[model samples]
Target: MDQTRIGTFIAVLRKEKGLTQKELAEQIGISDKTVSKWETGNGMPDIAYLSPLCEVLDINVNELLSGEKLPSEEYLGKAEENMKHLMQENQNNKNAGRWQGLVGIALLAVAVFLTFGLSQAKIGWYVDCPSIILIVCICAACVLFSGCRTKYEVVHFLRKTVLPAGLVVMVIMVPALLHSLSDPAAIGPNIAVMVLTLLYAAVAYLVLYVAETRMERRRKQN
Candidate 1:
């Protein structure tokens, strides 16, 4: 709906409010680059940011979406239309996420089934190689399909996934580590890999926790 026009209107509103891009971004808990993108029509603000963005710009949602101020008589009708559109978009996104989750689960189930069948058939590398490929494929599919729409949602997803992801990493690597230690030639490299992987996973969890905590603090402050 005239994204360029809306962007220009956002810039105008920001200027009218006597706020710099960085200042507005700080108030809204986003980066200056993100604010610039919104003002330049390179991207739209996330739906989660819409309310705070409108607040900081001293405008209402209808005015923001319409790319201009509206008279009192037109306000209700325009706002209603915008709200309907927003609700539909939200519903579509939710449905897409549900489908993605289901597909991911199905892929994992298929991978498990195939691995079991191959192993039972007494195949050597056939079981090992295809299982690895299937696992990798499932991971790629999940990464592509399970994208979050906003920074907060990303942080939330990370927080929820960190424990399970860390556990999975350890479960896969620990056994390999033990197996490697049994081989004299591979001891040094295996130890190094195991240590590094564990350290990296720990650091990832720590960073995610800190970031999520900070976001929570900011939300409470606001």
Candidate 2:
């Protein structure tokens, strides 16, 4: 879908209807900046606002989505095209989400390692370090990947066996990491930690996934 074309079409139609950005936004129950964002191709209208926007612009949903005025004959074709674009966009977003899940686990491993592994050193007190950043990154990534908004939900998801399993791996890996870090010729030093962490992570995730699926099934039966 050509966002710029759609934005321009929206701007032109608004003007043709003798409405300013603010007037159009007021009619559609959105802020002027939101309308401006659409007009500038910086954002698209929310799905909730699409119907209202179509009404105000005197256009059909297909036309608005297609970013062009359509003849009666081309309307169905445009609708199909728009549907394909939406599906492809959805697939891309889900793929990006998978990447977030991967990163979150990797960061979780690093955070657990550095947070505890560094204790073996001569440091007296724990201060700010890269591990803090790792934790923060993983926390933010978890919210995005898991869609867990509430604190309780996030905590519940993290405090399950998945985290404990990771911690166990990290603890066991620490002695190996310490020894390897000291050896100049240690082949692929951190590989064991990363592999064990990822292995445990995969197992934990599979267990949690099966548990959730069963719970969902039980809910449906009840």
Candidate 3:
């Protein structure tokens, strides 16, 4: 459900009742700031105020909660069905993210193979260092993603595993990059490896950000 829409509904209801926020708060026994927060979608009304708020607005609790006005029985039934579909879609998205993480690991494995076999003959030492770091990162990400399915787990794993791994990779890769800048022969491959590793790190951070945002919004809803 959209909290913003609920807030908009409340604002409209307040306007219809010809009541300012202060007046609404006075009638409902809440602070004006609480009413403002509800109207602005910054927060939800407390459970104890729900019934009284609806009463003052001359609307049903369901309508207030749902941000809809006396929806027909058939419409309510269809909305419930749509909500179930949305839940299923959310589950599918979570599964797809997991699958994508596995795909990333597979790609990292292939990169490791190519690094050891092809790059070893030309840039053996530099390639081995970053390759090992990349492998560790990919493995750690996969393990954390697999073992921790919830938001808390995701946040903890990112803080304790992903961030540290990324910092280590950067620590190793950065000096190698700086050293390679003095040698034209080493510059191309060094830059390419750095770019790829940084890209992967960025994607990992984005995934965590999205997961955490969804979790926070869900937390608010509950």
Candidate 4:
């Protein structure tokens, strides 16, 4: 959209209607300064103000966005152009969401590998510490990524990502657990760490679910 052209159109329409900027602004419930800004190409109306402004100017929203007084015969063409622009914008957003999902999955996989590596070592609470931090951080990244807009999508993404990777960690840990079981000094502590890791993973899943649900609600409201 061309702001300057739209502003000029607004100014021209106001003059043709024989109304001052202040009077037009009054009808639209905005300050005269806002009308001045629009006319001078310094600003555009908010989404909420678009309808009222268009009504006052005797123009449709498409004409306003296009920055012109469209001819009757060209109206449909202009509307079609606007629709394509909107669809392109939506496609771009979806592409961004896909990128975020890929990154989230990759991060989750890395966290899983780190946990698996830690399981083979004799580190005490450090195993839980770094793994817990990674789980928390990755969960936050998932929520922030905007990759899953619906509950089903969110769960599917987690299942495809977290569950498979988690299973790999478990599969690799089985042999280690078996070996540790034969060692009296290692058995109890290793089981305790595994239990703590699983508990933290569950908590991470819960946090992601709640955060994503809140975000979805907010997105819908907006």
Tell me how far candidate 4 lies from the true structure as C-alpha RMSD in angstroms: 12.3
Q: CA lDDT of 143 in candidate 2?
A: 60
Error of 2 at 46 (Å): 2.9
Each candidate's lDDT (Cα)?
A: 0.71, 0.71, 0.72, 0.72
Candidate 2, 95-184: lDDT as tens digits? 875796789789878986887787564332333233334434554566678888765465457545455455554565567667887675
- TM per model? 0.55, 0.52, 0.40, 0.40
Task: Encode model 1's per-residue lDDT on 23-88: one tens digit a residue.
Answer: 999999999999899889988777678889999888887889888999999999988888787677
* lDDT tens digits, residue span 108-217, model 4: 78887787676785446545674465554554466558477766576646633553343444455567789997798998777776666666666556655755654553
Best by TM-score: 1
lDDT of 3 by residue, 1-222 (tens): 566888999999999999999999999998999889998999877556777999999987667767868657656765675467556655776687679768978988898779877764444333445555674666566665578876577674674456556656767777888888889999888777765565556666776776676566455334
Candidate 1 deviant stretches above 4 angstroms: 119-222
- Cα lDDT of model 1 overall? 0.71
lDDT of 1 at 8: 95
lDDT of 2: 0.71
Q: What is the TM-score of candidate 3?
A: 0.40
